[model samples]
Target: MLSITGAVANSNGQKVFKTLKNEELHCSEAEMKAHLANLYEQQKGKCAITGIAMHLHGQDDCDSDMLVSPDRIDSYGHYSIGNVQFVCRFVNFWKMAQDNNRFAELLDRVVANRVADTV
Candidate 1:
């Protein structure tokens, strides 16, 4: 994808947007899995928020449950917190439909619960 940086003058004296620069964030599957493992372990085999066990499938193989749009994600993993949760599929599914406020509320609730449980 291209990113804009500065403005340039056009023939009609109107400012035309131009591409400033571009680079790719390459992440191989193996590296991704490693990162995911770290996140999974950090959360103690459960979601960072919900504290539910993460599931991939019958085989239980999921390196990262990536958000379709990175922009939509929260402030982890650049909105791509890899394997950062262990929620049931249903909860994960719910994430997709939640608005920003609702998502924040859910995460807050889960984190609070986890903290309380620990105490």
Candidate 2:
């Protein structure tokens, strides 16, 4: 049986375990952390979709929108190394709540609205 106490002891470990449980995916804590680190390097501490600065627990001001969470680029994909990326918690939740094409369209609309306001 999985140990909840140990899983919740570390923030990253907790996230890793939760993802495994919620998604019915399987991966080691070390592997998940490594994947998260890789995505952090690739994204340079920004949301994968929004490109906004991330709010890490110890590194930045905490915000609901900036909470980092693992995302599967292909929703049906396994929680493997290359398939996972880190995204803002809110953005990930929003994306999962809609169809991918619709989500993309809405994101484009939001970006366009922001750009229009700047003009």
Listed in order, each prediction's TM-score against the native is: 0.40, 0.64
Best by lDDT: 2
Question: On a 0 to 100 scale, what is the lDDT of residue 97 in model 2?
Answer: 42
Candidate 1 stretches greater than 4 Å from native: 1-26, 54-72, 75-86, 97-101, 106-119
What C-alpha lDDT does candidate 2 achieve relative to the native structure? 0.76
- Stretches off by above 4 angstroms in model 2 are 1-22, 97-102, 114-119
Q: Write the per-residue lDDT of candidate 1 for residues 20-46, one digit (tens) a residue.
A: 433233466576567666765675666
TM-score computed on alpha carbons, candidate 1: 0.40
- What's the lDDT for all of these models? 0.51, 0.76
- Cα lDDT tens digits, model 2, 1-119, are 25776665644633333344346456887977877787799899887777787787776468977888878877776787776777788889889845455777899999899999999
Residue 59 shift from truth in candidate 1, angstroms: 10
Output the lDDT of residue 60, model 1.
Answer: 42
- Who wins the TM-score comparison? 2
RMSD of each: 12.3, 11.8
Consecutive 10-residue window with the lowest summed lDDT within model 2: 13-22
